[model samples]
Target chain A: MPEQTDRTENPEHTLVEVRGFRMAYGATTVIDRLDFEVVRGETFGLLGSNGSGKTTTLRALLGLIVPTAGELTIGGEPYRPGRVRVGYLPEERGLYKREPVLEVMTYFGRLKGMTAGDADRWSRSWLERMGLADKARLALGKLSGGQQQKVQLGVTIMDDPELLILDEPTKGFDPVNQRLLMDIIAEQQRRGTTLVLVSHDMAQVERLADRVLLLKDGVARAYGSVADVRGEFGGKSLNEVFLEVYGTVGLEEDAA
Target chain B: MSAFGIVLRFEVARALRKKAFWIGALALPVIIGVIGLVQFLGAQSAQQAAEEQAKAGFEFVYLDASGVVDARLATELGGAPAADADSAIAQVRSGETEAFFDFPADPSTQPVTIAGRHVGVIDDGRYGAVATTLLAESAKTEIGSPELVAIVAGGVRTDVTTYLPDGSVSTAAQSLPVGILLLALLFLTVVLLGQQVLIVTTEEKENRVAEILLTTTRPNAVIAAKLVALAIAGVVQMLVVFVPVAIGWALFGGGLSIAGLDLSQVVFDPQQILLGVLILLGAAALFIVTLAAVGASAPSAKEAGGFSALSIILPLAPLYAAAIIVTQPSLPIVRVLTYFPFTAGTTSLLRNAFGTLPLVEGLLVAAILFVSAALVLRIAVRAFRRGALEYDRMLGWRDLLGRPAR
Candidate 1:
């Protein structure tokens, strides 16, 4: 295990931290000892190919999965929902498909600790903003795949959570909708929300991430600011750097 | 509202909103009511046909070789005296006589012969019934004492009150049906709610709503809320079913009896009813939590159904051995069932209702059920917490026991 320097050594600026984190299932270690921190008000790109322990890391950090032998904390304490305002967009996108779009959104909002009226109002406003104003009463299953993804994102950010963890938020989106989603994520970042964006799109990560962690085979292959990571890889683009690190096998896995 | 309340309210409201739930809830009562209505209408129609037949009048001739038949009685019953057997046979064969009755020399030992034009199979029973009535009337006239006639009529009813060793009146016969009724009710409720209980946790997993909810609330709280919500929904469903039945009972339950069980004679034992209720509550709680655990452990609702069926079968399994439970309540198998948490509800109810279960033993059974229910509930909650996020595979025993992943 290599010791990695924290960009911001001060605990107050670090909203998310993982120290010597390890996760295993039946002797199969999914994540080996790893270390990183997400500073307040910064977008941290957790970049990895498929099955590279990216989702597992996020799940562990959110306390959804128990860490085998290390510490994972948010806001200086282990994640306890409602203790800190947090939002998550899981890679496997789904909601109550039989339920009305607005109702599904509001149900999640209430679970996130928003008042019913506030949840309803926010959900309606979000539908309008996302150009899904006509879809409020329609069953979520009636929406197209891309539209459902937009609604899923709306649910994730509905409460204006202090921290947003998005896994493949722009997946299955057209270029224009992808741009709109990026803008919304950037807005959240500008509002001082610490964000962890997990994506395969190197350009999106390079444009949004202040610091990035490139993981391969459950180990951190590159860590620190995007510029420092690029420089570490001989000043190549993050895409070229990703190609160099994962090679053709990563591409094959990603395509699968 | 608290997260528990939110989850509970959402689950119950979701159930109430589904058309399938209401249809399922209303199905049993509707089918029962339809059956009852058909029976009632058929009875009325049969009765009306009989009254019309009586109004039209029946003409008959009698040849009494025994001389037991009184002339006045025969006249009152629309019977004419026939001079000889030949004349009576001729009249009946020519269709001039609707019917003819021949009383043998010894009417008590020898059968009365009825020669009549063919009536329908069921209607032919009226002839034999009327003949018996006529004989009884004539005998009453001959005896000249109402008491002797009453004794001869075979209308004696004996109410046997056996004393227990402690001199308490034995009400076992009276309580048998009541106990069976309670057991049946328990079986019915479990069957009605089994599928719903099973799907409560799996629905969240299948719909991918579990992770979102788990991120917001405590897992135990969510599981507990769902169990409570399922109970509430079950109660609601039963109410929908029973309300109409109660209304039906009020409207047309006159002369309604099951297997000759005069329900009116059933003694309402307050202590016994209370004990049965407590046992039921414990069993219901245990069943709900167990099924909920099964739901959480399974990856999908369909898979959970297989396990839920097994859980539903356990409580009702003792019913197959009901004869032993009732006849020999102290038998080892019966005692085991009475103490076992899953089977205890039905066994205890049966024993208590049959007046075979001692008060102390009944109370102990209730206590055992409650204690076991609590233990199972704790285990279920723990398993649910561990398995709630497992969407791709079933949770095995090792996972359920909370052991660290191998």
Candidate 2:
């Protein structure tokens, strides 16, 4: 166990520190000694090509998977395999299809140690904020996909986790819902919650992320502030920068 | 709240919300009730019809080839006596009588033939006595010497000895079948209910809802909640089957009028019932564990079905094998199965019902099953944790059997 540090002293304080992390599934090395940190009160974007290990890295950080080798600490404490104080939204979309919105949210909230009353109150507020108040009592399967994603977000925040790891939180959202999701992320940032956003949408990443890490071939190829990485690639957009580093290699392999 | 508590609460809420759970838990009982009611009505009507047919006097006839007994024997037999032997035989041949008996004229012969109209009649020892009595009486009228009469009476007495043990022995053996039938019912109930638990676990896992649940809660908690919910459902199902049959039996003249009913002995004692429930819980726990492990290991619901079939067949095999094993509890196959967790729960419970299970042996069997259940829960939790974390890799047997070296 370690003490929580004051965020004011270090604005770029490492809320989540991953050093030399490596993970492999039998013969396939998914993450190779990847080093990065999510600063306090900042939204960090994890950018990667299709097999770039973004999801793997997020899963490792959440203590869902024990890394083959590395050290991971959240808020100055080593991650306990089953007791990490974190909230994770897997890239694969899932919810108990038969559960109503309010019940599902409260259930996930309780898992994070929230009292029933508090969980219920906060879940209601979140549902209302996400424009799901009308469908609170409806089973999750009955809600539209985007609406279900909103409930997924609601589940993540109901416990007010110190670290929120969302893997493509805005994958299927319309622009309006996307904006709503971004606003929610922004609100979480305002509350000093450290967020790890994994997305392929470069524009969204550039706008929200304080820092960006580009993973290619199971290794970090670029790591720095969004602007610095952008400038290093000849002042191109983040997507262009991504293309420059990964596009040719992927294309050549595809062609061959 | 503790982590486990949170997981338990969440799982309960999630399971309760599922329409399938409700349908399985609540709706199944209603269906069982309907089925039971139909069967009960059908049985009642059949019984009533049989009773009506029996009351309509069945004509009975017999051939007295011994010739010593005449039409007077028919009068003594306590039915509408025929005018003569010819008429009695004719009635039986015409199907006016339900049955008729014929006695051999030669009473001193061995294996004397006694014939019936519809079937062969083997000597039941009682008929031999009756024939001897009629022959002795006729001989007494023909031979009028006191000394000869005493000699004949002495020989007849020697032939018929009162060696049969009073009544209790026969009564006990007569009630054995009822005990066996109850044991069979218990085994059947356990197998059916236990399978339901397995199917539910596999279905949820296949649908990926279990993954969502595992992510939010501990696997042990999920297993616990499922066991509790499913056990209640199972008990309700048992009641739905047992209660009506019991009420029907009682209402149908309180076990007296029913010729086949045997109530002279205790079929199920309190300890036996408690043990049966305990065994059921152990069986259900084992079911949840194996199914959860299978579900977690499978990549998709479709793949789960293949693995799930093993769980279904394993428990049921022992249940179907119970009848043969109940008779020979110490058989090597039965003994080995009684120690195994899944099979033991159903088989040993039934064995206990039949009084074949010694108290020490029963407790030991129960202990082994409980420990197996705990081990299963542990494995299930590990599988769930690993499965939840590794989303890209389809969960496989390798995850449980061979974890990555580090």
Candidate 3:
């Protein structure tokens, strides 16, 4: 794990802030009073077992759903398109599968506030960079799973959004392509983009995230810098720490 | 472009690119054209056969025992005097002459008899028509005064004008075509465009793209843009079918007039047409928004398919109740159909064309649709937010009623 400095001392550095967020569906509460923050220019890894409210939290943060009780804001205000440029790659992982890759990419680019010409240009460039230039005009469903994921990521980051929220961004990639995706994410980090990555892959999270938050059943189990989290959990790797948090059930679920 | 504009442009482009849309769009017109061509050719063949039959005169003979027969008129009408009824019948049976007509002495008390060669059942009626014309012409000649003959030859002709309670004067004939035209327009615009609206709205949920879309733009704008795009696409499809039909009518319509309708006597009312346009606009908005709501609430496009069919069937329900709409517009059933959002457009169009809809009632019906559309638009937006991430189960009353986490 790379050593990242702790920036919790400064309020101004916070890019994302969630306070007392509670979400309940009918009689059951999925998340209860959850709280966390991500500083600007740092990669924040949001880790959790399956059905542990990682997606729910991100959904609230991006204003995809209305929170039942608390505030989930980006850049100190509620997320709204054109208020801040945001790129979101959801965990469900889909696109307009019947549309051409370039067309789909360009459509999302324009929605993110790019001009048509600029959106087309950016889409083509991203397609080439992802080694999918030849598949640009093919229907998205015709491509392999990993190739489609690449195009989806390209759509998310094409307009250089200030905040990028990627839920399992490398879910379908092979190891080689996964490494390539990490490089691309690293470039975004260098551009000062704040990233909140949700993934089950502990090593990938440990390598990329400056700070990490481990959620279990919607409660924050561990938070702060990567090194601090590891040190607090017996100085073990994040993979070992994740096992401690979720127990053997997590292993069974992940295996399934 | 604004977000709404971008989404609208993209959606329209997507629909236009689908091969199914093009195929569906062109299919109806082609089928109609083929049917019309066949009918036209059939009519032409029948007319040619009739002209040939007329040229080959029916050399029939008549024995007028009443002494009122006009031989000159009978000859001109393709009949000649027969020496006796028995000989004429013999000739007809032997295929020497086409028919024989025997007029009774007391024509009023006893019926005139005719014997004709066997043709088809329908074609045999032409013999009766020819005999009747010959007898009427002979009677007119017996009257001897041209003025009296003119009055006797044709019965009194009367044209009726009705004064409606609303102080408008109209003939029943004037309203029929307008009513038919409006009904046809409603079917073309709503049922056809409705499928497009449902598909566009539900595909995002089926493909799991709604969440990403919600994050990229306001959910309300996304829904609104899709509604607008669908409306525009429907207009395009309507034009694809209507333009050629209208052009064909303009070119060939004079020769192929509706049999009972006299075009010169048909009066087109401007107010009725204008009200019809308003009803159309209101109906389009209401149906599109409602379909959007159905799409958002459904778990998948496949599930939404049932609701799509329901939406289409409901609007056209008024068609099945056409007897009540046309004859009893003041009935409770008509009132219910007129005020309900789904059935309002078709009911209003029917009433407006029939002149049974007052201006106030027409406006009220249109207002109901517009108001319902606005309310449904809000529901659709909220349903989108609630159902955006749900892939397996449909959003029911509980999910829609309960707000989602912010």
Candidate 4:
């Protein structure tokens, strides 16, 4: 199948673009000649197994790590601090556990340029909506893992960011809350928000992802719409496709 | 608000909310208050004892290897003499003797301390007065009154004046308070604010929140904000302690016959005051950024602690060395400490506050420290960005230097 259109060429509709991006730490190259674009209002899935450079790619784009060589842009501007309203929820649950949930939420909201009153008001509404109105006063450590995940979701969405990158947002949630959060994430994209979804749960991504990129050892193994990749990989389901991709990808890495 | 403002406000808010910060800030003053209370109680007890002593008079039990001073002391003060030093201590412990004056074993080198039973201000005043009279009589009879020795040992009164920077003369008592207050401020700022800088800087890594914070705000902004916030907190805390402590010290300090050498003259020198202020500001800048650099490269709060202790000790070492800096100001080690990054501010602040450091020399050291602070801040920001995620293993000096983490 032809590759899904990369919006980076247009630059107008692209919220994030990376062309010929290369990132290396000493002799170890985490990303080599990687190319991808996250366009405005698109739910783009970045799928890979552990150590497959999905997170590395995200980190490099966010300027957490300096890219060795690349032309990368956020909102058509070089990556400077606070250039756009970008929200990122890392995979490892990175909120301060000792801090109150509302506090972390309000701090992030203000960092995203909301006034104190607006941030507080919006955070309260999000907390109640996430069924965590009672837990707002408590520390994040007091909440169970699933409960903390919900509060983190409130933090990521409290400012109503224009672009979001969520890594496994449904990781510790039960099936009910998982579906609930998935719906909220989908609704966010429906309101003209762009998303870069990084998940190992291919079934979930297949449902929500408009387009998906499958990476193997820092290279794109498959890049197209979910349906197109499905057809290209013998019309298999995403679970079967993930297995087939990783099965061969492992061999490729071993060979390299 | 700017991202810098948000980070700084968050740091200050977090610090203020911490119970540990408040405890650390107020711990010194509470201890001082306890000591002052003890001192007040001691004064009361001594006053009661002094009245009893007037009726009883002084009894000296002594073991004077040198025969001259003790024989003269017994007749002059009319105290019973002891067989040996041990019995005299026993007598005092049992309230039989008022004091035991153990003269120096080597006279020229060893110290002679006066031990007293139920010692009070009256006893102290009488002991000095008596020791002087007997020593004077002995010198006139035995050594023909060495004129210089007689003059100083007689407690000859002086004008006790301090020449001001404004060409006005003031009492030595006034200079003591101002100089001591500044020295105390310098010490607390370095230790307290340095700790705050480490705690705030390392906490982000411990919480693993740097990943999110870095994306939203620059690393430099995050570091700058934490430093500024802690500085504000430090200044506020310093004032909170200063105003009350100074008031108490000033109000109750006069007419108390304390044994220690007077500090009213330590910072009384005109040139030292100006030099000390420069060093104090410079040292503050140096300590903040250097500690931030240490915190950034440390893998966890536990790892950061050793570095914090080092930071605390280096600045404070100069204060501990004040005796050497004051009397022997030209020592090579003292000069080296004044220019060293860690010791510079403290040595300059303390030495100058004690009137040892010259103005031109102290300013040059201050400029070096200021430049070092800026340079270290740049290093810290870079280290923070690179090492934020390498939490599983330690990041050390090499990691801070341009060597990327594997």
Winning model by DockQ: 3
Question: Which ten-residue region of model 2 chain A has the weakest summed lDDT?
Answer: A1-10
Q: With candidate 4 superimposed using the best TM-score fit, by how many Å does residue A23's alpha carbon deviate from the native?
A: 2.3
Order the candidates by TM-score, highest first: 1, 3, 4, 2
For residue B330, model 1's alpha carbon misses the true position, in angstroms, by 0.5
Error of 3 at A9 (Å): 5.5
Considering chain A alone, report the TM-score of candidate 4 relative to the true chain A.
0.90
Cα lDDT of model 2 by residue, A1-256, tens digit: 1112234367346688887789987899998778777787788889987778998787666556678888777776665424555777767767777767788788777776778899899999988877889998998889987888788777766777778888888777788778878788888889888889898888889988988898898888778888888887789989998888887787888999
Tens-digit lDDT string for candidate 4 (B1-406): 8888988888788778888888887997898889989998999887666544433456776655655574754665666557888788888788887777776545446555566765555556665455445444554566654776667567566656667689887444544455565677777887667667777778888887888888777777788888899888888788777778567658765533335554343335565566666667778888777788888888776788886788778888876787887678789988888788888876676665555666688779978988888898888887788778778766666667764422
User: Across residues B22-123, which tens digit of lDDT does each residue of candidate 1 receive?
Assistant: 988888888888998999899998877665554445788888888778889778878898788788888989999878888898988999998877788867
Per-residue lDDT of model 1, residues A113-232, tens digit only = 999999999999999988999999998989998888788888888888989998887777787778878888878977989999998789889999998998888899888889989998
Model 2: CAPRI class: acceptable
Which ten-residue region of model 2 chain B has the weakest summed lDDT?
A: B155-164
In candidate 3, which residue ranges exceed 4 Å CA deviation? A1-9, A248-256, B39-172, B249-256, B264-266, B404-406
TM-score of each: 0.82, 0.73, 0.81, 0.80
DockQ order of candidates, best first? 3, 4, 1, 2
Task: Write down the lDDT that model 4 would get.
Answer: 0.76
Steric clashes per prediction? 2, 3, 5, 1
lDDT of 4 at A115: 89
Per-residue alpha-carbon lDDT of candidate 3 for residues B107-183, written as tens digits (9 for 90 to 100): 77898898999888756766767776677777887788998876775755677788867987765468567756876
